[model samples]
Target: MPNTRWTIVTGASSGIGAEIARQFSAIGHNLVLVARRREKMEALAAELTAADRGFVEIVELDLAEPDAPAKLHAQVTQMGLGVHTLVNNAGFGLRGEFVDLGLEEQVTMIELNVTALTRLSRLFLPDLIKRGQGGILNVSSLAAFQAGPHMAVYHATKAYVLSLSEALHEEAKPFGVTVTALCPGATESEFGARAGMEGSRLFSRARMDAARVAKIGVEAYRAGHAVSTPGTRNKLVKALGRVLPRSVMRKAAGEMVG
Candidate 1:
């Protein structure tokens, strides 16, 4: 068993998740990358190991399962791996009218984006608190600032994440632990394709590189920021949303995805 303290990054096979993993590895952290694709994670593990980023562990499991968090906790404990950070980035978005989308798919999004994240945070957070360091970085979205009509549940999940991370940040401050919500606007990622959002007006504009998004997120997490929204454009959008009428933001958000 590796005695090194590890950073566990979920949804780490590619895109922003993979970029975040690379950033952590470059900074001298061993990693435990969790995702559904074993082959992709293995390839990534090889890359990180060859680069001398310390040991890499790949756990191929669907975290959407209700029991997966317990299994992950047991596995980490069995390996005697001290966790330094948790990155909850494994989630997908669906775009469509609520009534038109498949109910099961929407529910699955909730399971992955909301339930799994909450469970994993609950499972590993106490250890970080007890140790008086490290933190959890949750992947939120600019949509979190306002309602997204076509992607209603997705926006709601991110809003929950941002809220949860901010509250947790306050609770962990005395313990010297941070809880940061990394909110990025549309970036180049497989998630965009999977969510069928790549061609939307929001994504059609110049998108931030996945690497840059991760870099900013890592910096914010290190700085112990409770909320970090990457990109000047995204920051402006969020600021505007704060003052805009909800009905107007709703219309704009809904139109962006159309």
Candidate 2:
């Protein structure tokens, strides 16, 4: 009675999202790739299927769009695909003073990062619970541990992810559903460029490979780890953030990311 097939990967068009999709496909899991760019997803679907014989379904939908979660649920149901895994990775960071970054962008980040993630996890929970086995991997960041100065809203959204994932992990334990928060440190991705952080001196030193990060996250999710911070440095930083006074860690983190 194993409910096998179709893992939904949000933000699968690029970066960590794309890498996670690729890893799942490599392991012979059927995939449903969701993102705003249809062409990119189609291309990825082609590449993954061509490289191997894995099944890939491309759905181009903006997670930030209202009613997105409902539509996504309907589409999956109509396709007769039962989701056994969910990867909430579709989120972005806006760099700049919170007041100057424009209220719209800040709101959109919350909609996608916190709102969509919550809705999707809730929508899929019943199905997973009935089946008695499933997994959810939420892609958070090292920024979740402390308040960010310039990237205030983005950091706050990730903190929500981390907190929610941990709580859900414990709640879902008896139901046989595992929830994990994959907190990655600075990685080589187009995230900087998208967030207007291109060519910044802060990113010159953060050089983790995207593939490696994806691998670690997938393995951790499979192993049922409640939280997995990939790199040692990131793990240490999170530990310090947990133990240090909020004021002290906040200032240090702001300076580091600033």
Candidate 3:
């Protein structure tokens, strides 16, 4: 009964994660949607199933919990779902002076953004390697390119994601397992409000649609690309971040999110 072709997408209840699920389903891939929001995931499952895109299995769980990765893997095993693709997209951001943010919240952010992602990857990567035709798409951010002063922890976490993904891309390549890092700039999603960044200058400019970004990411993964930063503007911005002075970059980032 193992659904050996299932794609496991974390944070699949909303935003980029939800869009990614939609795209994957459209391509005939059955999905295991993981998120804390059961109702939302159930709704999405109904829609996807109604469209006859693919089968959808909603798994409501908080990835931020320390044991979530193990629990998730066990659940998948129980369901006989072979995870052919793992999308580590369950993460969040916080905007404010590092010192002003609640220590507990920031730590939880790290737990989800970095710890949970690593745990899940470690848990699922072996199977993907054995399959030799699967992929891992990690959702990093444009912030990964440089230091983000006001959103230091969030930026750092994304940087970790980008670094890990790129390195894994090379290591997994010989096994025919593709790893890709998706870096998106400002996006129109609940992320801005949740992160307290809605009024920031970063969102003052036009933001990319989550659906478009998701499509680009999924396509890049399928193409075996190591990294994909959607949007021409975002690509240019990341390119500039590469050569810009550290001080200048830091100041600009601070101002944009401060």
Candidate 4:
């Protein structure tokens, strides 16, 4: 049994999730790095262990599976590991009109983004309550604030995450559980490529850096903030979404993402 406080970071094989795991490692937190790519996670564990003298457990998982959370809970329980933090960062995007994208892709997105996140949070909340202190960081997106035409389903999933995280923040306050929604803008990663936007100049022009995004997410969660938008531009976009009419916001988002 691992007796130390454990921070579980999903999608930790690469990109933002990897950076988040790295940040947690720097602070001496033992990790359970979850991803579908076992080799990548093992490599990350090796690097973090060597560099920071930190401990990391690699779990090759596909969060899109409905039974993943339950399996994860059982594994952690069997190991007698105490989870102090959970970062729900395993999600992807599909870039196309709703009618143009295949139904399976959208379903997979929902499975990973909404169902997996909700289940993990619910599964871990009780333990955190018993311990009287813990944190949950949900990785949403700046698109969560508005309706995106090209990324409708993905944006909608993130909106659910943001709303759910905000509500959880309030509900968990008395229980000493902090919930934070990390709303990052277009990040410099292979996400755009995977989403079929590899040639997008707009994506390339965006200012988000994965490391900075991870830092902001961890800092916000530690500070007990309910929401964290990494970049100033993203912050402004959030504010605008709040102030603008829903129709106008939707149109603007469509233009930007389309």
**TM-score for all models, in order of appearance:** 0.98, 0.96, 0.98, 0.96
Query: Relative to the unseen true structure, what is the C-alpha lDDT of residue 10 in candidate 2, on a scale of 0 to 100?
Result: 97
Q: What C-alpha RMSD separates each model from the true structure?
A: 1.4, 1.7, 1.4, 1.6
Q: Tens digit of lDDT per residue, candidate 4, span 1-258?
A: 434879999999999999999988888789999999999998999998889546788888898999999898889889888899999999999889999899998999999999999999999988898898987999999988888888899989999999999999999999888999999998987688888766554585766889999998999899999999998888888899888899998888777657
Candidates' C-alpha lDDT: 0.93, 0.89, 0.93, 0.89
In angstroms, how far off is 45's CA in candidate 4? 0.7
Candidate 2 structure quality by residue, lDDT tens digits, 1-258: 432577999999989999999888877788999999998899989998898646888888889987998899899999999788999999999888988989998999999999999999999888987888877999999889889898899999999999999999999889999999999978888788888766545576766888999999999999999999998878888899878999999888777667
Quote the positional error of residue 175 for candidate 3 in Å.
0.4
Candidate 2: TM-score? 0.96
**Pick by TM-score: 2 or 4, better one:** 4
lDDT of 3 by residue, 183-217 (tens): 99999888999999989999988999999999999
| Maximum-lDDT candidate | 1
Top-down TM-score ranking? 1, 3, 4, 2
Q: In model 1, which range of ten residues has the least summed lDDT?
A: 1-10
> How much lDDT does candidate 2 score?
0.89
Model 1: lDDT to the true structure: 0.93
Instruction: Tell me the deviation in Å of residue 70 in model 1.
Output: 1.1
Model 1, stretches more than 4 Å misplaced? 1-3
Clashes of 1: 0
